[model samples]
Structure formats: C-alpha cells, structure tokens
Target: MFKNNNTCLAVFTGIIGVVFFSAKAVMVKLAYQYDVSPVNLLMFRMLFALPFYIVILFITRKKSEEHGLGVKDFIWLLFFGFIGYYLASYFDFLGLQYIKASIERVILFIYPTIVVILSAVFLKRKVGPVQILAIAITYVGVLVAFWDEFRIEGSEFLTGAGLIFLSALTYASYLTGSDFLIPKFGVLRFTSYAMIIACISVVTHCSLSEEASLSGYHANVYWLGLAMAFLSTVIPSFMVSYSIKEIGASNFSVLGSLGPVSTIILASIFLDEKFTILQMGGTIIVIFGVVVISLQKRRKHT
Candidate 1:
C-alpha cells in the first residue's frame, strides 16, 4: 500500500512539475513582447527566485550537516549549477526569442533521451534493445514536430531549434551529474544550494554582459518575471527534484513528456499560437514513446 501511494505521489508530482515547467516558455515568450532581452529576463527571474532558494538553504542547512557536504561536493554543486540552471536556462530563454513556445517545449523534451544516452556512455549503464527502440521513437517524433515547424517557418527554425537542443543537452548533463550528487547531499539541500549557485552565476553574467539594463523596464515585465520566478522556477524545480527522488530520474523524465503537450495547449490559449495537424500528431507520438520508456523502467524495477 505504501509503495502504491508513493508511486501515486511521484506521478502527481511529476505531472505538476512538468506542467509548471511548461509554463516557463510561454511566460518567456510573453515577456519578450516587452522587448526584454534574454539576459535581462533571465537575470530578473533568478533575482526574484534568489530569496526562495535562500530560504530553502536555511531550512535545509541543519539537515545537510547530517551528511556533511565536502569541498568536492560543493565544487560539483557549483559546476552543475552553472551548467544545469544557468547555461541551460540562458540558452532556453534565448531560443524562445526565435521559436514558438510549442516547438521550444518539444525540443526540450529530448532531454530524457539525452539523459539516457549520457548515462549509458558516461556512467557505463547498459542500454538494452528496448531502450534503443524507445529512443528512436522519441526522435522520430521530434523530427515530425521539427518538420512541421520548418515547413511553416522556413530556414529560420534551425537557429532556434539548435539553441533549444543545446539547452536540452546542458540540462541532461545537469541531470546526469545530479543523479550522483542528489544521493549524497539530499534532494532539498542539493536543490537549494545548487540553485543558489546558479543564481549567483546568472547575476554575474548579467553584470558582465550589459545586454539589457536591469532597471527601467515596464512594470508588466517585472510582474511577468516574478511569475516566472515563482510559478516556473522555484515551484517546479522542487517538485521535479522531489519527483526524481521518489521515482528515479529515468521514470521522472518519462513523465516529462507531458511538458510539450501542456506547453502547446498553454501557448494556443495564451499566446494564440497555431498548430498544424502534423505537429499535433508528432506531439502524440512523442508522448507515446515516452510512455513506453516509462513502462519499461517500471517493469525493470518491479
């Protein structure tokens, strides 16, 4: 009974996390309408999100000492914080400037496949034939989605898709690294500390880049930033970490397939983005592939 309950909890958390995370692209696209640069937008997001992480740090500080993070742990946290949150988010924000939110979410959905491949290569985990099939199905879905976008948008789609693909790669790297560290540091502690590091990295980058002034934006942009900070950043971050803790990264990532669908729906409603039948079919295929992966993972564990 307890195991069943835990599974249910993980599923709920995963779904909610994916939904909120999906909102991020929509929110970023909306903020772009105000002429906010990606750097400035990311800076505002991290700035507003900074305090919540600090609070998490304080809450988890004492508990963290039970395991007692070492110099190496701190170093790893810093590295991943930069790669996972800072670099990935920067690339994603920049990419959203060029692509529709729906496309951006679908591209980002590839991270799970990236994570699976990275695990096999870097961690020496064996990828079975089933897993290989799952990966192929996922990519075919992505190609279908990409083809739809490319047909409508022309060659310009490549730039945004490439950037978002990079975002998925970096994010997958972060997840790969975190799989090792989350066991040592504990989920809440690791998430809080790593995000704090990401916050600092984002602030420093903004300071150096001079891309957009921090101040003097329309009040609406700041509000949108705050929404992104709370709705998309802090809440989803914790929920995802918790879900990973409960379900493991592979299963958690499979649940992330929902992200693209949620984003497409939200984009249609909020951003008035249109989707073709091919894109919709592609989204279904992607979800089906991911569901297959999730079922395989479950069977292996059971």
Candidate 2:
C-alpha cells in the first residue's frame, strides 16, 4: 500500500515536471539575449541546481539507507550522470540555439519512443502486440507533428535535428542505467549520488572547455538561469528518478510522452507559437498511443 502511494505521488511529480521543463526552450532564449554560450549557460544552470537538489536530499536523508558506493557504483554513477544529465542537457541547449523552442520540444519528445525501443532490445522485455502498434501510431504522430522541418533542407535544421537525436539517445541510456542501480541502492539514495556526480561531471566538462568562467552576463539573466535550473533540471531529475523507481521504466515512459505535449502547450503560451493542424493531430495520436501502451500493461498484469 505504501508503495502504491509513492507510485501515485511520483507520477504526479513527473506530470508537474513535464510542465516545468517545457519552459526550457524559452529560458534558453532569454539566456541567449545575454550572449551566453550554451556551455556557459548549462554550467550556471547545473551549478545552481546542484545545491538545491543536495539540500533536498540532506533534509530527507532519513528516508533512504546510506550505502557504501565503492569503485563499481561510482564508475556506473559517473557514466550515467555524464550521459543522462550532463550530455543530454548540454546537447539540448546547444540544439535550441539553432532551432525554435517549439520545434526543439517536438523533436525531443522522440525520446519516449527511444526509451521503449531500448527497453525492448536491451532489457529483453516482452511488449504486447497492441503496445507495438501504439508505438507505431505514436511514431506516425511524431512524423506528422514535424513534417514541416523533417525535410532534407538547411544545414542548421539538420544539425538541430542531429543534436536533439543525440539528446534523446543519451537520455534513453540514462533511463536504462538508472535501472541498474535502483534495485540495489533504493531510489532516493541512488538518485542523490547520481545527481551529485552529474553535477561534478558538468563542472569538470565546463572547466575543460573553459566555460567554467562566468562573466559578461547581466543581473536579469541570473533569475532566468535559476528558473531553468530549478524548474527543468533539479525538479524533473528527482521526479523522473523517483517515478522510475515507483512505477517502473515503461510506465514512466508512458507518462513521458506527455512531455512534448506539455512543451507544445507551454510554447503556445509563452512563445506565442500557434499550433498547426498536423501538430494537433499528432498530439491526439500520441495520446492514443500512450493509452494503448497503458492498457496493454494492465491486460498483461491481469
């Protein structure tokens, strides 16, 4: 019963996170007005987020069992952190520089499908036939949603698409890697370590790239940076790991599809980006796919 409660809570958090993270493209735009490089931008964002997530873990330490993270755990932790948070966010921000937030979000939404495929291939999990069809439907939706720019066109568009694809792959790998530790370390403990490690990795990357230095940015940009860190990075990171722990990856991915939809809605509001007919149709198809995925899981459990 307690587990079930956590599951519900985690899912709710993930949903809220979906909404929170959708503003990232906008945040990146606001930050760019200060002439900040993507790397420097990410450095400030992650650096600020580090303390916030750390404080939360410190306050709730009692809920988790502290374990010795020896060489093996740290090795895995560092790898996952690098790939999951550091690489994913870095590429995402860089990609956003060349693409509209609305387009970037729709592209990033492909990660859910990637997660499903990776789980089936690497985890050797059995997905129902209906689930397969649902995924196909979702893919169709994704293509339809992006038909405007998926064409063979400008190098900038191609680059944005490539970088976003990398973000999705790394993010998918991060999801898979988390599953490796959650069973042994418990969700919260593993999460606490993973985040701290990723923060370190980002710092290291910044130092090596000479992006560690902060300068030439106005005071106004700091607030936007904080909002990005807190809203997009820290909160969503915690919620995603928590949701993965509670509901399992597939269901989490089920909820994850809402991200692009949420991003679109947020774009509509803050970006004044109007929705196209194809995007609306794509959103409907994606939702239908998620429904099919969930129903398939229920059917299997029964």
Whole-model Cα lDDT of every candidate shown, in order: 0.83, 0.75
Alpha carbon RMSD to native, model 2: 2.7
Question: Tens-digit lDDT track for model 1 on 1-302?
Answer: 56656666776887898899899999999898898999999999999999999998898788767455678887888898889999999999988888899889877988987888777787776667876777677667767755755557756678998999999999988987887788888888888877888899989888898575878888989999999999998998988888777766655667777788788789989999886687688778878876786666556555
Candidate 2: residue 166 Cα off by (Å): 1.2
Taking all chains together, each candidate's TM-score versus the true structure is 0.91, 0.87
The Cα error of candidate 2 at residue 101, in Å, is 1.6
Give per-residue CA lDDT, model 2, range 89-147, as digits (tens).
88898898888777787678777667777777888766656656766777777777767
Error at 1, model 1, angstroms: 3.3
Q: Which stretches of candidate 1 lie over 4 Å from their true place?
A: 66-68, 142-146, 153-155, 296-302
